[model samples]
Target: MWPAVGLTRSLYLKELYVARSRWRSGVGTVLMRTLFEVAAKHECSRVEWTTDANNPGAQRFYADLAFQQLPSKLFFRADATAIEHGLG
Candidate 1:
């Protein structure tokens, strides 16, 4: 997700998924490197993303990539009406 905040543009990597068969094959590394390159080209000051708290592998991967983990909470308030309206 790319969002303009004041005068700066930011990059948010909402998801990065590789097929299980491709894990440990360096595909994720290459992809992340490419993402950084793209972010740089776009002059993005920060790249943000989130992972499940239970997903240790994802946490380690982001940590290895030098991403700092911030304390945060994921919240949702979706009712049946919201779901029906596709706003959930």
Candidate 2:
């Protein structure tokens, strides 16, 4: 679900999904367009989302909608280095 707020120039799509059998049947397009329209109604000038790096299908889907790939950053935290040294 996407969050709805007062009219703004930015839009964010938290998540979207379609049935596997319905791929390329215009459902995804319609869903995106509808979302865009909703965003536009709220004065949103941009729509954005994130997908897993290994999800080629999702990547292609977003690409078809004119979404350009942007550089990303990831961070991880680890602790207790000795905790796993002797334990399997």
The C-alpha lDDT values of all candidates are 0.82, 0.79
Query: Model 1 segments beyond 4 Å from truth?
Result: 1-6, 72-80, 83-88
Residue 57 in model 1: lDDT: 90
The clash numbers for all candidates, in the given order, read: 0, 0
Give lDDT tens digits, candidate 1, residues 1-88.
4456666778878789999999888899999999889989989987767888799998888888787787674645688987889942
- Best by lDDT, which number? 1
Pairs that clash in candidate 1: none
Q: How high is each candidate's TM-score?
A: 0.73, 0.68
Worst 10 residues of 2 by lDDT: 1-10
